[model samples]
Target: MKTAASSVISDNDNTPAQSIPRSPRLLETLLANLDGVVYRCRDDAQWTVEFVSEGCLQLTGYLPEELLLNQRISFLELIHPDDRQMVRAHVDDCVRLRRRFDVEYRIVHVEGAIRWVWGRGVGIYNADGEVEALEGFMQDVTERKEAAQALQEAERRYRSIFENAIEGVFQTTPDGTYIAVNPALARIYGYRSPEDLIVSLRDIRHQLYVEPERRSEFMRLMEEHGSVSNFESRVYRRDGDIIWISENARAVYGDAGTLVFYEGTVEAITERKLYEAEMRHQATHDALTGLPNRNMLHDHLQRAIQSARQKGGLTAVAFVDLDQFKYINDSLGHQVGDELLKTVAQRLMSCVRDSDMVARQGGDEFVLVLQNQTEGDVGIAEVMQRILAAVSRPWQAGDREFHITSSIGVSRYPTDGKDVETLLKNADSAMYKAKEQGRNNFQFFAPWMDTQVSNRLEMLISLRRALDQQEFKLFYQPKLSLKDGRIIGAEALIRWESPEQGMVAPDRFIPFAEEAGLIVPIGEWVLRTACRQNKAWQDAGLPPIPVAVNLSPRQMNQALPEFVANVLADSGLSASWLELEITENVVMKDAEKTVATLNTLKRLGLQISVDDFGTGYSSLSYLRRFPVDALKIDKSFVRDIARDADSAAIVKAVISLAHILNLRVIAEGVEDEEQHAFLRENGCDEVQGYYFGKPMTVDDFTDRLRKEAVQAAP
Candidate 1:
């Protein structure tokens, strides 16, 4: 056994020798095949080498012949200057202990490049106690040493980053067991320390992450790409509060490159996720009521329509308009109006299902989108009735108990119209019908409602043309004094004789004109024409009964007093010869604005009268505040004064109220002797009715004036 081992060592370290030893011959053969040099050298400052192999030439870039047997360079000259002392010290220390010496150091090669080498030597002691030689092995170990140094540097750099990184860094085993974690990781995991996290969070899936699938997904991504990027998932903190995190990770491999564990970093993104969700919600919701707005309504309705059409079911779009909203807004201020709208919106929303949508179209208008229904229009009607009842219930605002009402109009998808705009228009038209039936009502569209819609469209078209073609004319109705039976004034009334539809009455289209915002222009034209015609009457030797022109509420507000002043100036008529007849409802539309406008009108020296008095709800105390000259009893009272005691009482009350207000009185709608006699007995200052004379054409009116003037000759 010793022979075999000696033979193996000799073959691995063959060297030149004078003795004919079989081991040496085998060693020579092995040394010739080796990648290291075997040498025998004297222990001295410049150790003289007795023999060297060809491997030395490859290691130090020098020939073996140049360093052999003290003939030329020695072994000590091969070492780098900076590492030579340390190498020498280690070698001496090993030699003094009479043991094997081993040293690794950098060497300066013959070519002037640096090389690292590992030297091992066993000192051979002579019997006289002097060092004979150092027989050892030397090889090129520069590559291994450099690789070890580079690995150490990389470990240090990674440790520094792991300790200081903002995102958490961690390492876990393949079974989702936490192996190691940095301080950042510990804090992210809501642990007191890194050790605490590694100990407590043994099972990452169960202990750390809220969803176990996230860990599985993490494993999946690692397997697919050997890494992960922005792997977001929800995790529970130590306190059990969930938070969102994003991970950049990699699968760590072992010695054989089999995946052993997952190494990753995670960053919290809870705030960013919350902000994105809020942004999405705000984009779809109304800012005022925090409900779905028109934009969301369109999407919801479209989807519902498609579903209903496919299933042969019902979907409705009901347009809800708050009744008398304008009056409430004008009287109570917009703050109160806004509160009322919010209350109504909440109540209306409560009456519908979560699947349905309640959207505010803007200001007192809402559009409800109803979803699938098997009962078709019946279901829509029931829903609308429920919503109307809910919204109209009494609400307390501040200290006042206020009662509100709504007009609801429903149009079904595929039944009323296929598209949103058409359905909305149809619903709006039906909503007007709801208003026409005196509000607090719901109207489902019928075929006759289409006729009213067409009429309105025709009226709007005629109006646009009326301004250009001069088809609209002013007719004067004489207001005669009751005592003298002479023309005290005349009322200027609008008469439309369209080329298509001739002879439109004031009652038939005036309300439509007011709604369309065409009344301002039409009313201004009436004022200017009446002022000019009145001056013309004076020019033609007719009595100038200050021409009275009725002003709609819209006209009174939309046209400034300056516009009226300009019209009066342009017509070259005296301001005192013009009277503006406004209804009590119109004057009380906005008390402050109305008073300001009336004061401006009064400054122009024009007489102002409240028309259709005792009909609208105006406080008698407030009536004294108006800048007006007279009050006209509404025709409703006169229509039934002879039959209804209530009508007579209303008429008498209006006259007394006008007198208390220090305003003159005029009675309208006096067609018979009873109404006239009743109004006269009530001390009404004047009367303008068919009992006096009916409204007539300009030529006939002039003829009557001639006849009256002939009778008036004294």
Candidate 2:
């Protein structure tokens, strides 16, 4: 009953077979419970199996009887065909060296599926050191091998993207040192390679960014927000050129939640930043003159006002207007006008300090903002005088030399105005006053000027309403024949009877009408009303007399003759009974055109008289060429005739000149009997003043005319 298995165990135990109480079943149970195959094979070419454990069925899909002792198939045949020679060589070398052999290879199952397996073996040797058999353990390890190969593939893909990305990728230490940089990051920073960037750029804060504080700001944002998107900065390249860049980055923390480094992607934005700057410049600067425009001027003025308030200094805003620019543009051409404006712009810029700003307020107007002036008006005045001299210096325009002048008006901050709009508006008002002061000068804004401006604006608004509401009336002042002391004619004067303010003087609103272009309509109303009233008097069986109506400069257009004729026709009055009076300046503004228009009116049988005769620049030659029948002495000369010898001489000379030209001369504003006697003694053709009669209503004049007619009839 003692079989071979028992004998083998008993021989190995020596004296311990009874003492150890060894069981033959203990060896079988240990081998049967293993998850892998345990085998002993002869060290032959076939690796013929001598014993195979029960795990052989699950590991190789073969029963132990089928593999053991080459009963069905040898263990060597169970290995994949491709791995047989390598396995044999490896095991044979280990056996010859008397060392353990460990290997991993492929094996084929009985079902024809390939699986990965690991084998570890040691040689079972005899006392004589002769190779007997190989004993090894083999296991299935296919899942672990496949998992490791997949991880290798993923790593390869990540490395490819990192190397070839367009945007720069980097990992930087928390202290602003580069830990890792891709090839793209190196090229973006103007380096030869990633290794070159790492070696050369040690301090990102000092060596990379143009402004070193940008790096600190970056670190601050990272600490506060844990990430940053679109972090823009100006940085320098290896070639010492500056460029703009934007970064998207986050703090890379270690497993312990402490920040280790920052990982980021950077994009170059130099071109975009440059384009934005250019666009901003274009928006704030003038296209033709290259000066700051109105928009920029407002912004700069606001800042200047604020600075002056804070620093305790004065700021001046000068409004400049080219005096003769309109005439030049109308006569020469807009091309020459544009060239002149450019020249003036340059001259203005040269007149101010670098700290000041000159801006174009559009259309022959420029504004200068002088900042931080300790010398106050004296410094502002000096700069204005320099501007005046520079602008007056003659410059060429299309090969023609011309001399032009500018009128400047200045307003100081915290005095004339405290805000931008108030300052500019006050300056404009002062500019008009400069023009009124005969142009080619500068005026500082006064508090009274602001009151005048406010009053003028209110008057203009009221004037517009007055015309629509028929708040106007005509008063007639009789003109006497000095030779006979008889009422020969009457002058129709306009009066405004306002509901809000009673009896506004003509001096208060007439100038406004002229400037605001409302005079033409008001002048036409006077002409038509005078004509109709004169005709009504004639119809009332009174003596027929001519009524004089004053014409404004704006009303002296070429169509005036037709307009007068239409009025004459509409009122059913003869043109001979209506006289048109124009100021001396109006007639002399454009001599040739004025002569033509006067001739046309004279042909319609209306008499023309030059009013305010001594106040304008009219030469003898132009006066002779004018087709006027009478000249009215200006009130300025008549008022001072007795006191001022110059006034007396001017009046007398005008009388003699008018007579020489065969034109009637009339003296107005003959207030006293002495002035009347002087005018009559000087051979003046007519006289009209307060001494004769003040301006009266139409009914009052008509009654006087009736009384004169009755006296003549008797």
Q: List the residue pairs that clash in candidate 2.
A: none
Model 2: residues with Cα > 4 Å off, grouped in runs: 1-33, 37-99, 106-115, 122-135, 172-177, 215-231, 247-263, 287-289, 321-343, 362-364, 392-407, 432-441, 446-714
Give the per-residue lDDT digits (tens) of candidate 1, residues 1-714: 346646555567755433336665667788877888899888887888888887888888889989986556678888888987998888888888998998888888888999988889898898987788889998889899889989999999988998888889888888888887889878887899999987787778878778898888888878889999988889999889999999998888889988888888889998767644544454455444667766667777878877877887777888999988888889997557867888888998898888888988766899988877667777777888888789878888788888889998888777889988778888888888898889988998765787566778987887878877898877768888877778888887789998777898877778688779888888878888888888887888976678898887887663568888998889888999999999866876688888888999899999999887755445554677889999888775687787766557556766776797788999887888987778777888888888788877778778888788888888
Q: Which ten residues in a row have the lowest lDDT in candidate 1?
A: 279-288
For 1-714, candidate 2 gives per-residue lDDT tens digits of 556766677878776555543356767888899888899999888899998899888888889999878888888898899999999889999999999999999999989998889999999999999989999999889888888778988888988899989999999898877888899888888999999998999999999999999999998999999999999999988999888999999998899989888998999999768744643454466545768877789889999999888987899999999988989999997557867988999999898889999999877999999998889899888898999999999878667788999999999999989999999988998888788889999999987765566778898999999999999999999999998888999999999999989998898799899889999999988998999999999898888889999999899889999999999999999989988999866876788999999999999998999998755546567889889999999875787676656568667878987998999998898888878878888999999999989999888887888888888785
Best by TM-score: 2
Residue 218, candidate 2: Cα error in Å is 4.3
TM-score of each: 0.50, 0.52
Instruction: Give the number of colliding residue pairs in candidate 1.
Output: 2
